[model samples]
Target: MLLMFLSRFRVLISGLSIALFIVLYGFFSMRYVPLSIPWLRLVDFSFWILSLGSCLAGFLDLYLFWRKSPLISTLLITIIGLSITFFARLLSVFYSLLMTSFSIQILGGSLIDKESFVITTGAVAGSFLILGSTSIHTIYKEPIIFLKSSTLYDLMNTLRNTPIVYGSVRELSNDYYIIH
Candidate 1:
């Protein structure tokens, strides 16, 4: 159910909510205007939306992995999902802190010169950094191989040692090896 929403609606909502939160917080954090409501109130909704999206993504990932691995998929998804949530919260803190710090400058009779390009580029880079780093780490670790047992390793070895693949790969004569 959650995955369905995430795959379809949750992604858009979370992304928009995060963007809205960033804009609103960035606005208030830099200016420190008197609020009729509260300071950074929009952030609460954004955080929840982001958390739900992360869990949905994680659950769907586990479901896909369930075919090959019942245990490892469950564990990795749970752990990584939690970690993503934690990191998102940290980024939110960074956003809030940066805004608040800038607010003092604005209040001190300094003009807030907004650079549209810089914000867009920063957002793109930050998104890439967050997503790219996690993906690269996952690829380097090759966690899927770890989920395999000794039996699977032996089977893979058997396949790799087959004459067709061996001749193509090693370019060795049949007499160089023995088949018992």
Candidate 2:
């Protein structure tokens, strides 16, 4: 159980770190130069798509997580929604930054020169797909893990010691013996 939590913790932190780095890179670069370069029009579209996807995915994730762990209903309803909103916005920025970088690489053009619109769009879109994929995968796993790892699983197991969580221990033991 501890190992499971630790692994989950690491993945969450790593994903968040990468997301933060991408967002920072985007904003910092924009500060020095305007975000809209003529070549990078695609980047804008990609960011928009990414933004939309994040919002949708976040809502879906929250709903599923709530269904799995109804105990955290209020927290999930309010805080989870906020968290999803923040992630969606952050993801769009990160996608833009990554796409911008990729576009520069593909063009084999001098990084010093600003790119045109199309290159930006492709790059931004690509970035969104990459980052969004990770988020989608994590969201898919969260509910399953939370539902299975709840105190209910532990309490269910403890019932084995009492012969109450399920039914009669003599019958259970006999069944187990017969199966073995």
Candidate 3:
């Protein structure tokens, strides 16, 4: 079990690290280097990479669900969702900043407006907050039951072997008594 846990932990860490590296590299490359590739293509490729990473993390979460506590599983899912949402939003901000900087370098004035950035960031934050609250509420409201057949049988046996306690009794008459 320990070996299995360590292997899964390594996989999770490596996956997140690779995803972070890709996002950083992509952002820096887009911002600093001038490539002949179209901006739309770059955006599409970045989205695809981000989607793939999210999918991989989701699969890993599902694969290890049974081994983890329900609370931990719920937290992992929530964190993964929030991280992906944050990264995607960050990438959008980085793209916008790069565009604004590039335009300013060429035009001597900022062509990009701040309203769009503000709106986008606000919307992302609002949605993330709503999602997080709902997820946590749902997770706490639901109970986790991981009982196996053998475990159920053992529980029944143990319950059967336990002694039963009787409450105090009240005497009604010589031959009649009531147990409370």
Which has the greatest lDDT? 3
Best by TM-score: 1
Candidate 1, residue 15: how far the Cα is off, in Å: 6.2
Model 3 whole-model lDDT (C-alpha atoms) = 0.41
- Can you write out model 2's per-residue Cα lDDT over 48-153, one digit (the tens) per residue? 4443444444444344444344333232333344454455444434454575574543322212223333233343333343345335446565432323233323
Please provide TM-scores, in order, for all candidate models, with all chains considered together.
0.35, 0.28, 0.31
Model 3 spans with C-alpha error above 4 angstroms = 1-37, 66-68, 71-180
Tell me the tens digit of each residue's lDDT in model 3 across 20-122. Answer: 6467547756675333334333433443344444444333333444234343334344445545555555555555568666443211121133432342233
TM-score (C-alpha, index-matched) for candidate 2: 0.28
Worst 10-residue lDDT window, candidate 1 = 108-117
